[model samples]
Target: MAGSTFVIAGQNAIRRFKPKDHIFETLATHVDQEMLNKPNDLAFDALGNLVFTCPGNSRQEPTGYICALQPDGRVTKIPEHMYFPNGLAFAPFEDALIIAETYRHRLWKGHWNASALKWEDAHPWVEVGGPIGPDGMAFDQAGNLYVAIFDQAQIKQINPQGEIREVYPLSGRRPTNCAFDLSGKHGLIVTEAERGEILSLSVDQPGFPLFRGNNGWK
Candidate 1:
């Protein structure tokens, strides 16, 4: 997984691709039936376990859930029921996982219990204003969060205190997801889904390099 690329499809499937041989392998399919109707976004834990969000029907329903895909191919649905859970990310230097509830315009945090292999102590972290939809999210080295405001053509930066610090406008394009480049140049890359293009923005703060945990694969 350290050298592979993982992708999630709208058809309710997750695939793993090997860059070396250009081989594509099915990691999970028909996962909707096993979890929820839609699998939105995913992130890997410190131990390489896949954590994903399922926002069923794109509404504020209890049908939404957070799920985990273990290394052994086992799927586990987390015990919390959410309303349209969307983008999620692991905290930069904390034992926490943050998730966005698109329909509610809020962000929630959950403590990761490594010994139990689950997330616990779930609570609301932030309440975003306006009618903008919160989608994909990423964390910076300073523990700040950058969330893509879907349908609003902007990205909002939330500090560790869960307060909106800055709102950056994207060139009139609907952004669906965002992440910091791995080049250590502190450039933020956003997906302009409406135009089928990727936009990059220069930032003063560098992002936390993902997969840097002690348990991460070398």
Candidate 2:
């Protein structure tokens, strides 16, 4: 599905799009009847469940939620009160879900039990400094949690022991997401607020240019 591109909650209300010809097919118009319907990030779980975040109607309206779009085109809410949940990932080697609360600068973790269709074991994973504006997150093999601090122009590494190890500075000011390379020694970072550029850096050489633009991130 790499070639497939979907514009979420657009004016036309399309759900799926194929990029081969840049064709957007409307799968659900007014699909999100419950919320304001602005879609956010999407990621797949280990079981290939297509999970998505939509911080609809601000924090005032009771619309934003973490939802999973089933294979049969059914949408179900997993958890409520996510508060502009931005980034997510299945923890290092566990089934637990790690969510980045964008506005709260906090990390929330929970477990998904299929029978319940709702998340439980909710708790704070980590909370960064004032308005660090946390975003995309990833985990290293060593169990170190790496968070892209949006406004801080840095990446904060949280070790397995719950220690905030080091703040690695970045050339870009607003890093929105991050992912480790296949080798696990480097990272691919993306900035959203600034031109939507990407950067690649090593775990050791935290500061220099390993790559830039889209070419560097992959």
The CA lDDT of each predicted structure is 0.79, 0.64
Instruction: Kindly list the per-residue Cα lDDT of model 2 for residues 101-158, writing each as its tens digit.
Output: 7777788888865444566797887887646567877776666778888888888887
Off by over 4 Å in 2: 1-9, 12-22, 25-32, 57-63, 114-116, 181-186, 204-218
Candidate topping TM-score: 1
Clash counts for the predictions, in order:
0, 0
What ranges in model 1 sit over 4 Å off?
Answer: 30-36, 130-132, 213-218
Taking all chains together, the TM-score of candidate 2 against the true structure is 0.75
Most lDDT-accurate candidate: 1
As a whole number from 0 to 100, the lDDT of residue 139 in candidate 2 is 70
Model 2 / residue 75 / CA error / Å: 0.4
Global lDDT for candidate 2? 0.64
- State the lDDT of candidate 1 residue by residue for 1-218, as single tens digits: 55777788756777788888799877776443653457779988888778888777757466787788776776777855677888999997889999998878888888997556678888888987537578998888899899998888888999988889999989855788989987866389999888788888777688776655435322
